[model samples]
Target: MSAAPFGFFGKIIEIDLTGGDARVLPLDTALVADYLGGRGLATRLFYDAVDPQCDPLGPDNVVVIAASPLIGTTAPTSARGHMVFKSPLTGVIGTSNSGGGWGHTFKSAGYDALVIKGKADSPVWIDIAPGKIEVLPAHHLWGQDIHATNDELTSGFEAGSRPRALCIGPGGENLVLYAVVGNDKNRVYGRCGGGAVWGSKNLKAIRVQGKEKIQIHDKERYQSGYDQALYLLRQAPVTKRLMRELGTAGLVELINVINMLPHRNFQDCTHRPEDLERMSGETIAKTILEKAAGCYLCPIGCQRHTRIDGDDGSTQRGEGPEYETVVLMGPDCGIYDLAAITTANYRCNELGIDTISFGGTVACAMELGERGLLGAEKEGGLDLRFGAAAELEKLAVDTAHRRGAGALLAEGSYRLAERCGRADLSMTVKKLELPAYDPRASFTQALGYMTSPSGACHLRGGYAVSLAFFGGTKEIPRFSLLQSPIAIRNMQNTGILQDSLGVCRFTGYAFGSDPWSRMLTGVTGMDFSVFRLEEIENRVASLERLFNVEAGATAADDALPPRFAETPIVVAGEEKMVSEQAQERMRRDYYSVRGWDSEGRPTRALLEDLAIAPRAGRAS
Candidate 1:
């Protein structure tokens, strides 16, 4: 295969823990050309290596580290990475994208991606530098929390660098399926059980550092394109305000406006109207935000660094109570104390647990408590109620440590609910709990939550961006009852493309301005224009669908939780609803647009057009 200049490292690193072997493999340039990078590359890799029947937490499972052309670039918000794996929490494929210095470091470390497989018999940590790789024993670090692990590693190396580290905490050590790998303290590749996979492998952490300079094919042109893109981004009202005011937490109010905020395990979509403004992003920004931080070379620093006033007259500084964390652990779980929520956010960071799953799981427990399914005995003698801030923190720590009832909650809401014989109490898709948004309030996101490779999540394709960015109507399409299927497909395809590029979707606001496309052309000197890139994006989306099909996912898998279809939100004294027929029709139109059959399987012709060859077990 020819070298992929288009900002691609054109190399894949495979680590075999069982054999203690590592090798640099060539990335398929054809695949790179067709699928782009990040999630696209990851899906293709999973198609080649993993079987649908493989246990998600087993040694055979593959965890993909993917970076794209824009990664490590001067392009605004371009430093991001995706960690893709089959979810232990959910039986489905999952991809969790995160922002940090890690992607940039990995890209500059001379590899485009890392595919790790096979379990190690003993704990180990891999330190990958620009040209060197060392697999070190991690026996002593086996039980440390994520923050302490990062701290010790940084101090031990004496590199005078606080290099980004992705480490599993006690949650992962105890095999919690919802365990997460945290880096940049607060940022996480959060949704999937990648942490459990790491834990099972006896891998403590992956510490990476790279001093290698990023090389662009046409440095001058790249700089020019980047400058122009930054200008447009600065002018975008939402993007600008996001930078100046709330960072990404700005979405809190927007979700509130549509009454989509997942409150009390989604038994209610809106919080009490009086508390709306107090719990809004605007409030968080005004009250707690102390500063903003950024990663690597990005100019738009959307990460809010805040200090929350804890009880006992002390304070704790953390990354954020971003919209999702604020809603999921805050109002959703019934904790309105911003300080308490921030403390919980910090605790999750320190413990390396995903806030979404951690908080949602607690919300599920609270709902069960309210329904009389769980009381003192079931909760180990603590009153688990939504909005009990003290209990929220207790549960947070307990879940991380896997103590008492925390053991059950740590397994994720779906499994926990099943164990308690109240499956309806878990607000989730597949097995992962839904993020902050209520699907009944935003049908596009409902589709996003349901069909995301991961379980219920918002990152797959944020439909709120549809209303906020695209000239859509006042409300985010709440019922995928009509055009949502097609619109969602478009968003998913573009989302994959954006992820492949390893650039922030925030740059989409600057689309057509040629900033990112120019960076692509300049970095690798690949002759790509924005229009052609869109075509590649389309092919990548189709490729992902094909891979999922080969892995046994069918049209039946593309479905919302039954509650979403059966229970309509009572808003403005009217029923806001989505019907089965509407979803089916929308999905049908979506399939047609993507050149797929009624079963939502990609057609042979479509595969050929997209240069995706069918493997032996792939059904026609």
Candidate 2:
């Protein structure tokens, strides 16, 4: 306890904007033992800082930025950072993660996490450098997009030792609920309104730069674990070839082949072969791709660098329209033009908005327009029809700047549906829009979305589509109502472990429990095993559930949207829905496994067994 943990710098900082003060605090070793790092420790800190009574957009809401233990080292794909906050979008306990270079630098600055609170009197940004911390005026940077902000911040800074700025765009400045906090001008903590939270605090950005070597406790053991992880990454076909070579967009046609690709706002789950081909990763690579980009310590390099000719004869370049962004923005909106999707993706990153939410909500408006319910000439002169590339591009900007119908569209899909009196048309759970995968086509995927803390989130819900579409490591039935819950739980645990460790989720594809355990034990000098890691993952999830329950969650919140219950995907003339009976069974099975009541709240005994107790801020 006296010396720093092998993988940590043994420092945590809390900043209060209202008072313009900051403090470094000590984290308990036992607490660190229970909830390793990344999202786990951040979740615990969130509960300690904010309760159900806290207003999400107000100063009372807590913003926790934490790093995983494996960061700042030779660990593969280890540069990850997590943010846990009260979601201004979903009105629940929320979290988002990013990996570029921020975490490693932050750790090098000798801190494990940063908790931000209160609000600045004016626009400001925090500077974190080795042995230095200060809040500086950002009045001029207030209205700029993330790209411009990045350029301005790094303008005169030393290129060799430049600080990495994580900032928001005009979307956040306008309080667009789904605004993103972007890192390195492209990589973002994209979901659950992380940018809006920053905007609320009058915080424009955070810049981190540092120089420190991360010490390895056991060199031989760490090398052995590191080598195993590297070997797995090289050997895994999906990670090395499919993701590294083709990028995530390669899965577009693969999902289409399985009849699980969401098209036209979930009205159809598959597209015509030609359209699917046009929107696939191969098409992007052939047309406008410049290169593949990788995060810190990552081997796969799944990020695609694309550039397409702009309307004025210039070229627009951006990082990625990952599979989720491509499918949600392309097929979901019925726009198969890859260039158009690329432009929309570019606009999203530039403006700091969640492309999934923005595209999905716009697609909902498209369906509403088709039904004559909305989007008329009187409705802000908006063309909410499907497949209008120009309109789509315009709307992306409008949403970020809160222009025209973009103002309404910024409310996100669930609230937009409520305003239009058509929540049934919205493909969402817990008010957050669904990702690219249609749950009706994949039962396990459906369960994950329904029960996810962030509401219909695919990644937070464990991306069960790996087993459902691509053959994953575990062999589980994609459609069996009986067996999918087990796999979903396993996937969720794996996600928790990865998130907690601050490594890329793709690591799960390459290495399983053994590699992860070896990495943690070797780097941190902790006794790690598959069994111990699962326990920690479960404890983390249980604590999150406890946070939500205290935040007024119920079993009803664990259910899907009304559309998923009634409307079924007619794929190849086979009507398929997750079904009321199957969904009920999955919920029951998952609850039984979690030792929770039917309402998804962890029982007292379960918390006791996990050594988790409700904190002082937990709501009565």
Candidate 3:
């Protein structure tokens, strides 16, 4: 027991589920200085803890959860937790982030990170507190839905101070490739099959509670940055008013306006104006929204707590159907019934499923059915048709339980389409399903998805749509090849910095890295200036690339599906498509800008220059 860093506990807990043994490892000051925390720290730890080619769902896979130094401070939306592991779905690095009390509480429990490896012989959950850790049996909690498990695990604590719980439901237990891990009942680590990884290890939940406070080295510097951040957030329309009024679903109408909205598995971005209105954010706000909420210490308040009428004539209350969920499940599936999408959204959350992937998978299935690909017998009598709103709710349940056709969908869209003998039909990149945005409308976005380490993720990529609309002076031409590669690289780096800092992505709409660098330096008494932060961002990006390369990724994997190049979507009255030539050029330029080789591997010299040592043998 030694004194920790000013802003960190400087401790990591490594738990072996096989023997139920836990050991405390001292966090290195150099590692903290290089990687900061959250995604970067977790990735560095995970890379050393598991073989690059290890089975993602096997005992050898490592799950690293880390908190940034900003978590226990007054930083806006600083409660995010970053989870890194090899993805069961994509077979690349899986980096997922979540917002809730869990990360904040986990840091409060006197540790900066928790690394779980090996597997339990039976169902279990981990309880963590200051100076205490336990691996407890959770057989009774097995097969329970997310809400129930959360309630059952978090009960009996003092009011307002209940320990936070992160758990999966039947989806994870069945090893659905796109299952999520839920926290705060609604907030989730909602991508890259983290839930399936947890399920494979027989982990049911992780409960944490503590009250340790982080020390700020310079209160004056911290307050200065905090004030500037708040002022800018107030000045930004998206953060100040739009999010609170309409939630992320507010983007429904806006994205449609930009021709970025996908319809019917991205056959085209065209949609009937009336249909868009039916499921738009305005409709949700006026129809079913119960209230707006925010994550721990967040001011944007973009969370949508709403109620929808069930087919059984009863009202059900739950969280979103966010913009991605709404479009992917509604318009992408050609289903405009808001109530049905909302109901299905609730089911996905309860079942611990990633709604974005599930929706994309369903849309792919529908496209296959339309093209006479999904055989009637293979469908198990399910509709599997676009605009089949009646079947959306049932699909959620079936997918989670691996029942009927869900067994195929449980493998995700790539496997499902490949099973149907049409791998090209799957709207995916690197096996992870695409989000709601159609990449054809924006070359920068298309490049982002092509180069994103996590595959087709807007957040993990660049969220380039934000630049098109709300990037203020930072906005660039969406279709400029000369500008897109560098622009997207910078955007992705900004995202890396934000994720590593445990901050929200939406904050980019208001401000950039300066305020965050100030706040981080103020709290940690470290020189996290903009230049140093950029270096760290490049280091983390290259490290992630190194992991993917060792895991068998190549330049070919950095590509969009053929549909983007084969078909055209009209943007601003001009037909647009990301041609193979364009993709290759952008990909090559992106690799060059990232200091990677043309084959998309981090060059030895570049790695050495970043001071990133080559991966060593697995850690004990």
Candidate 4:
């Protein structure tokens, strides 16, 4: 805790809009090492500064943008950034990960993180330069759409020197619970009501332009480690194909093989699986691609820049819908048009909306229609039936604008369903909608969704690697219901290790590779054995779970949607049911692995083992 600079830029910026004050604070390495930066660091700060029960869509909310140690360094796939805030949707800790140059740029801007609190008297924008910070009035920018705001900011600034900007649009200004902060026009720190936080703050944009360079502990070793990672990724089929072929969208076809392509919500996953093959990135390249795109320091180039011929003869050009957005907004909502799906994808990012939540909301409305709850009388007289592309597009626009019933839909799928008395129709974890992964088919993902920190999210620990990609399915290990619990608990611990390290979960496809650990060693010059790294990951995951428990989350919140647990999913003419008996066994196993009681809460002994000993202090 000395004043000497170390691995970090050795600084964090705290901004207070209510009092219009700003200050730089020294970095605490203890916090960095324990919390591990990015999501973990932001969560630690949140726990220390804000009350657990604070309303997420209020001026008192704290939003922190954090970067990891590997960011802006010679690490592969280090383009990830995080936006953390108390969630308006879940009323608990929420953080969203995004891929772009924002994180690195923010670090370069002379700070490792920005903790924003309070509200401006009027709409305003934050401008950060090499050595200047300004809070300018944004009256003219108010009510402008996301694209327009990006356009104005880019044009208003000097050419070829526009700072990276993260801003909320009308959706956020309206405090929509699913609102997000759109970055680079098409990329977003999407999910967990970030836009609503922006709205509550009377803030329009955060513009960062830093000329400072990141200092690594050992440049030679870092470069060597990075070269090894780059070499391995280039030779690896999964990484290369994902970059060259379809990007992450390539998983669309792979997951479909195991009946994991969610179609029409969790009610049914059965679909024309072959149709996925025709829509690969290779196919998109031939059909409608304009070019490929990537973020800063990223050689993988997994982002696709595409142009599709719209029905009106105009064309839509931007980052095409990735796998999760494509499925969640396309097949999950029962819409199938590729061009339409891409357009909707662009619209979601442009409107500062979370596609997963928005699509889940629309799907719930569609299901409600089947039950005679939503129709002309409700839903602003829009017939929210499944597979209606034009209607779906209209709904997307409406929700973005918060027009008519779109206002309610913009509250997210969970809240929308609750309003209609069909909450069970909405497949969600906490208040977040289920992502593209269907756990009924992949038991690993099922357990992940049920136990994730930020609702039903797959990225927490995408078990598809072990389950469908690698040896996870070799024998389909027939575990008696008695053994299923122990197996799932083991997987959860392994997954926690990866997330805590802030590495791409794809590295799990080659687990023994230890890509993240090697990068950590290279960057920090701290030799860490694989076993020690796994222990750190386990402890980090356990810490996050404890944070949730202290905030009142319980085993009751750990259960899946009634539909997912009670109903049978008939996929490809095969009936697959996630029985309650099976789920109970798995939950028990997960609890045991973390050394918790039958309930999912962390055990006192387990916390001590993780070195997060109980003390008279806040959860952080």
Candidate 5:
């Protein structure tokens, strides 16, 4: 009802796909003040609009995409978009972020967020611009891969007004549990099952183009933070040269150096030095890398644009085979062929599957086959051996299509292992497959994974390994029990702020919340001091915990698989594993620091203190 704030349009587009109806709603300024934006704001809106216990793929499931106030600004890496939904894979809160031009363009379309509810009778795509919105029939777009869908939807627009599309490929249409949403051709909301949610609703894509400008209230203050951030980013070795030179896969050797690299479904962290080099960032850069790219306004330029020569002498061009894709699909499965991993990476992107989850699931299947758990008949004659490089790309195609052995792989590692009667073999926390990092080496990282709202996400789970490798002054002891709890808590909160602000996680390597505080205050003309930002981070984290708890999550759910405890990996000449005693103690300490009760539920008093309304029958 009132005018929007300086940094925001204070508008939300609500779409009811069942009826093909859309309405523009005024976003409450007070809510924006409390939640900030992006992940924080989307989470608040989603928690209130949908039932926590609703089936994830059912019509009742809701999807919320919000852009931060900084999105349309000049801040580095300010083009990220945050999406939240109930995860079909993990069956809990599904939160994911992506870096690309889509977020900035969506914000520039004169709205702050988009919310979709109910299910469409057929496939459709939403077209948005200033003062115009329509749900168009997308029957022709339904079965297309991500690149085709993107090109088809974004075509016909004028040069400067070409729309940016966020869409799902065949993986999503088939409802592969870990399907990802692709934007800017390759950038993806890669974690959780957001693409599956889009599929369930019969939504193909949402294309947006606009030229709306954001208002900056204090240019001097904003410039001050901007200058400091750039200076610090230039000074940090990770952001300054390492990312620009080698990209994220550069971490392969470094992570291996710390004994944190996973191998053979996390059987061990051992790898031959040559094998490591074969899949490292240096290999990608030297062998297949066509060029390095960056997202909107990003300086780190971690995006890897590469090409690989096919056996038939055909050269295929695509992006990535980043650290996670390389290790998880390579040595973790006992295959270190860069060409194989890169080819698989391209297939996963085109099909809209999550490389991390797919790799982990394949490794699980390999272990199952090695132990005689996989039925020979059901495998369709595909070898499920640990080093089956031939099956790597084939499995990706099958999984996306839910065909043959991939039907089992499509269910993710947890379900595949459980169906095979060996749930313990699944290396996951909360059913979401763990990232490339082996938690046995870092106690703080292990704690972060345990407490992360959306299952075992390194980004959502604090990215504690970053501190281990590049924290500089902010780094903490990786194995300290006393420091692990609060340390991980702070790291998770920092992640919350970055996601909420729509910034890059790599930016944290350069500076903390102070610079961002100044920029936010300058843009919104509001008091966003470090203390207030911390309060907002705590509130958002507590709110997410509330949603999970109401969805039947418990302290028990915040745990790693049995392998993390029983199987110890040697680190620094000593066997290391997260013991049960250590896990319980750290979990308890984390809850205390987060102001949650012992059972991992937020107390009603604490919720009230943070201004989060308690759901009915919760926070008792």
Candidate 6:
């Protein structure tokens, strides 16, 4: 095959940790064109390399680090990076995305993705600088937290260098299933056991730095599109001002206004006005937020830098308790103390655990306790009660150590609740805990969650909650069930395009596929039209569904937990629940659109049409 195109170096670095061998392989540019990049290409690569029957934590499970065509480009929010692996937590194909300097830095090292297979015989880490790869022993660094690990890896390097690292903490060392692989000590491959996978491999971190120049086919046109995207970024209400000024935490109040903010284990979606204010972005801004940070190529500084005093009187400094963390730890767990939430968020980051999973698990345990399930001696004299900010604080640390009740909590809400005989109280889908958005309140978002490839997730399916909470092409009525299926499918396709291109979702608010098409065509000289990108999205979505099916998932696994489908989260006089009838309608329409069978498996004809049937086994 000929060398890859301008925007893509078309290289994949495959490391076999079990045998301590590394190979630099040529990536298929045709596959790049078909899948686009990032999540799409990564999933395709994973399908080829993974065994559907392999345990997610076993040596057979494959992990791919996906660097998109847009990485290191001037494309707005193009700093995002992605990983595709089988999740130990959800027991499905795992796709995790994050933004920081890692993608750009690694791309600069002149490789497209890192495909790691097998396990290291012992704790190890890799340092990849331009033209060099060193596998070093990490036994001494094994137990360190994310921050400490980052510090250890970069200690000898000069200040303000371009090296980026992804590391796990004690959570991973001990195999917390919800462990995270943190990039830059803050932004993380935060969902679906990315860290647990790393732990399983006895791999601690991957640090890279490079200065290789990235080429663009049409620099002038690429610049123009980049400029247009930047202009639109400035014009967006959420991106330009709100996100830049208040960080993602700014969204806490907006979600609260819509009454979609989950509180007290989602038993109530709405909170008292005062309680809402207490956890509001404005409150965080005025109280603990020290600054707003941004990712590479992103003008919107929605990342937060926060600090607060701990009970021990020591200062705790950390990057966000982002909107999800704030609510999941605060309102969802019924802890309204901003400082407490911030502190807990700090500890979670250091421990390399997912805040969403960590806090949501605690919230579920709290509800179990409230329902008299804890029976007093709930492991280590635990006071698993809602509104206990102190316990919430302790929970993060204990969960990291997997101490007592923490061991049960570490299994995630689905298994934990099953053992507790309170599975009805667990708010999750396909085993992954839900995000801050309540499905009952955001009807379309709920539909997206049900069929999301990575289980009950917000981003992987689509962040349709955005269209309803804020303004969009037109106002979307939250209650209109009929508008949801098609709308969610379209949004999910758009999401795939965004993730495939390695751009931040925040910038997705400002522009559409037209500008993205411009970036793709101008840089790589591909015939990347808006229509073609949509097909690529459909192709990617179907491929992921097929992977899940090959792993034994069916329509029965596609429904929401009983909490959202059965119990109504009361709000103002309205008995609100995601009607089961509406959900069935949405699923049928979604499957029809994608040519999927009732079993949620992709049809042979549809696979052939997408031209992914052959590789529905190696691609970009």
Per-residue CA lDDT of candidate 3, range 1-620, in tens? 44556889889999999999998999986788889999999999998888889999999999999999888999888999999999999999999999988999999998999999999999999999998999999999999999999999898989867899999999999999999999879999999999999999999999999999889999899888999999999999999999999999998889888999999999999888888998888999999999999999999999999998766899899999799999999999999999989999999999999999999999999999888886753647544789999899989999999998788778999988887789999999999999888999889999999988999999888878775544577668888888899989988999999999999999998999999988999999988999999999999999999999999999999999899999999999999999999999999899899888879899889988998976656322
User: In order, what lDDT does every prediction score?
Assistant: 0.75, 0.84, 0.91, 0.72, 0.91, 0.84
- Tens digit per residue, CA lDDT, model 1, 105-158: 788787888888888899998888777777789988988888788887766554
What residue runs in model 3 are displaced by over 4 Å at the alpha carbon? 1-3, 376-379, 468-474, 616-620
- Residue 451: error of model 3 in Å? 0.8
Candidate 2 pairs with clashing backbones: none
For lDDT, candidate 1 versus 3, the one ahead is 3
Residue-level lDDT tens digits of model 4 in 1-620:
65424346768788899988888877777666666667766766666666666777777788887777777675766756776788888876777777676676777677777789888889999887667778889999999888889888766667546578788988898888888898868778787788988998999998888767666666776676667777777776766665656677777777777677888876777778656655655666677777776766555667778888866789777787788877877788787777777877777777788888888888887878777876443737545777877776667778878888787788887877777777888888888888887877756667777777777777653354454334544533422345444555555555554433444545454334365666666676555457766666666667667767867888888878888777777545667666776778777777876677887877887877877644326342
User: Which structure is stronger by lDDT: 2 or 4?
Assistant: 2
Clashes of each: 3, 0, 0, 0, 0, 0
TM-score of 4: 0.92
lDDT of 6 by residue, 1-620 (tens): 66786888888889999988888989988888889889988988888888877899999989998888878787878877889999998888889999888888889998898999999999999989877887889988998999999988877877766488888998887788889988887999899988889899999999998877678898777787888898998898988889867777777877777778998888877677787787677888888888887988778888888888666888878888788998998899988888788888888899988999888898988888888886533765544888888776667777888887777788888777787777877788888989998888877888888999998889997787665546666867666677777788888888888889999888778888888888888898878889989889999999999888888788877788877877887644688887678788788877887789876788888888888855432442
What's the TM for model 6? Answer: 0.96
- Model 6 spans with C-alpha error above 4 angstroms: 159-161, 311-313, 375-377, 380-383, 468-473, 571-573, 615-620
Worst 10 residues of 6 by lDDT: 611-620
Q: What is the lDDT for 196 in model 5?
A: 92
Between candidates 2 and 4, the one scoring higher on TM-score is 2
